[model samples]
Target: MTISKHIYFAAPMFANSDLRYNAYLVKKIRQLNHQVTVYLPQENGDINEKSAYADSKMIAQADADEVLKSDLLIAILDGLVIDPGVASEIGIAFAKEIPVIGLYSDTRQQGADNQKKLAALQETAENQFHYLNLFTAGLVKLNGQITNNEEDFLHGIQKFLETGEINDLS
Candidate 1:
């Protein structure tokens, strides 16, 4: 018998791209394992609906409760910076010792071995890669890992489910 797992998906939900990407990844994760239940915050209309009036405390408490209950957290680290809400969720998970899997799919992160890219990093204002807050990223690494793409993210979840541990897949 498969043991059930709860995953809290923390991501930016304001843009069409963010919404669609979150849905797609959540679907893929669900398909990956029948016993997994993903709690996507945007789907919680009570606190997330723009037309509704959920106070800041209400939203924080709600999401924090879910984070505490989750077996794992999948944080999308693809925006200009890690979304503030997502960062808070990460902190909560870190404090509670819940494992977190971060997905950072920025295109600029590609071509790691390219000489030109390496050279550009040395030039002032010529950095080609995006920066992620190291403290937040470190929190994830302490309990889990950050995957660069969808496949690795799913793989990380699978590995975590089967072994109760996560690894650096970068």
Candidate 2:
């Protein structure tokens, strides 16, 4: 809890057809007096917000290199399963010795997933990718977990960024 931090956001991109909670989160982080870089999977779908920021889409090593410079990571681990890309990014952050704070709503009690639904296909998942079901696997390595109020979520991340050792998800 004694270090200044540069935060990087890891989550689903705006291109994701499901329209997860990352956008709202990105907006919140922007409101802060700090700059943050986002890392998400490159998606192929109709997206309006996709052009809003300088997104770091992961497709190779350079993207991973970009992530290493961050002092901390805020991962939106909201998915039926832990998003593979987010997990990988988290791992990379771990390798570089950066702390990761995960935030997610507990809405995993939804329903079955259509494993083959095309992005162009119009369908909806039960909740915001159901983080409840994937909690342990998703956040085992994180320094903190925000499972309820947004204030707590924000505070948790802020604490991690400010101190770097609360839960030590790093």
The best candidate by lDDT is 1
| Superposition TM-score, candidate 2 onto the true structure | 0.58
The C-alpha stretches of model 1 lying farther than 4 A from their native spots are 168-170
TM-score list, all predictions? 0.94, 0.58
Lowest-sum lDDT 10-residue window in model 1: 161-170
Candidate 2 residue pairs in backbone clash: 1-163, 142-169, 143-169
lDDT tens digits by residue: candidate 2, 1-170:
33445666677664445355566776676455364444333432222235554434424454566568776677766656656767787778766767676766545333336444333234565233333434444443554454445666677765655555656323
Please, what are the lDDT tens digits per residue for candidate 1 over residues 28-90?
Answer: 889878888899999999999989899999999999999999999999998899999999999
- Give residue 125's error in model 2 in angstroms: 18
Go through the candidates in order and give each one's C-alpha lDDT: 0.90, 0.56
Locate the minimum summed-lDDT window of 10 residues in model 2.
40-49
RMSD of 2: 9.4
